[model samples]
Target: EDQVTQSPEALRLQEGESSSLNCSYTVSGLRGLFWYRQDPGKGPEFLFTLYSAGEEKEKERLKATLTKKESFLHITAPKPEDSATYLCAVQRGSNDYKLSFGAGTTVTVRA
Candidate 1:
């Protein structure tokens, strides 16, 4: 069965600390993997899309990389403002715009 799972459901980081979040998934007929950042009370903001293994994407302090079975979101020198819930999702087969999202990793950066 196709599924997505994230570890360390919640994390607390001192300002300027760096960390990496994990997203493990298994899907049949894989299509794409996506990452998003969601602020409190707001919808998720698109971060990256990985189409194949060994693909990587970066924006600001966040870098996302994918492998055949999992993906990782690495946060570098995070600030307090970077606190948010990072989500991992996947689309398989002909799902079109549909995505299966993992539980998400909530990160808090405190000064």
Candidate 2:
């Protein structure tokens, strides 16, 4: 089974404060690691895809990087609008579309 674990289940940050979220995984045959941002009561929005170690992707203040056993989502100078639940998922070779997700890190950026 592919499993993912994210740290600091919840975060409270003042506006303009930056932080990083961690996603650690254990899988039999790793296919890809994915990062998503989900607002309250909404489906997750895709953020990045990491197929191999050392792969990185960025969008505005969000940057995602992957390694052999973990991935990191770095948020730089976040605002209240950037607050959301960040989810980390993993897909194994057996299933192309099925993703096992972590519990998610809920970020609260207060203005």
Candidate 3:
């Protein structure tokens, strides 16, 4: 079975606080790991795609890294607007676009 789970269902942080959110997953055959940020009432916006362990991608204050069994989304110096739900998805097998999404970690940054 393929599944994704995120820790700390909700995180409250002060402005400029740096923290990392965890995304633990178990997939049959890992093809690709995807990271996305979703705002309220909106769909997920793609952030990064990691194909192998030790691979990483970054954008602004957000950086994502993947491993054989899990992934982490590190946020550096987050601001109030950075508050949002971060989701992780995985695509297993060749040509498999079936995304298994996590419940997501809702982060709130207080400025």
Candidate 4:
């Protein structure tokens, strides 16, 4: 069984403040780790996919890093528009279509 836990269920930040969200997980056979951003009424938007430890990906003001036991989503100088629920999900194996997801960490950036 694969399990994911995201810390700091909710976050409040000033417009230019930067912070990192943590996603811890345990899986039998790790295939890939994924990061997503979801708004109030929309489906989750894909952000990054890390296939191995020490891997990283970046887009705009967000960066995603992967390790053997956890992943981190770093927000750099976030703006009000960056406010969203960040979700972390994991795939168990190479051919697995099912994903285990965390409850998500809701980030609110105030301008």
Residue ranges of candidate 3 with Cα displaced over 4 Å: 94-96
Q: What is the lDDT of every predicted structure here?
A: 0.93, 0.93, 0.92, 0.95
> Which residue pairs show collisions in model 2?
none
lDDT score at residue 76, model 1, on the 0-100 scale: 96
TM-score head-to-head 1 vs 4, winner: 4
Q: Scored by Cα lDDT, where does model 2 land?
A: 0.93
Off by over 4 Å in 1: 95-97
Looking at model 1, residue 98 earns an lDDT score of 58
Cα distance off (Å), candidate 1, residue 105: 0.3
Q: Give residue 94's lDDT in candidate 2 (0 to 100).
A: 79
RMSD of every candidate to native, in Å, equals 1.2, 1.2, 1.1, 1.0
TM-score, structure 1 vs. true: 0.94
lDDT of 2 at 102: 100
Q: What is residue 82's positional error in candidate 2, in angstroms? A: 0.7
Residue ranges of candidate 2 with Cα displaced over 4 Å: 95-97
* Higher-TM-score candidate of 2 and 4: 4
Clashes of each: 0, 0, 0, 0
Best prediction by lDDT? 4
Q: Evaluated with TM-score, which candidate comes out highest?
A: 4
Error of 2 at 45 (Å): 1.1
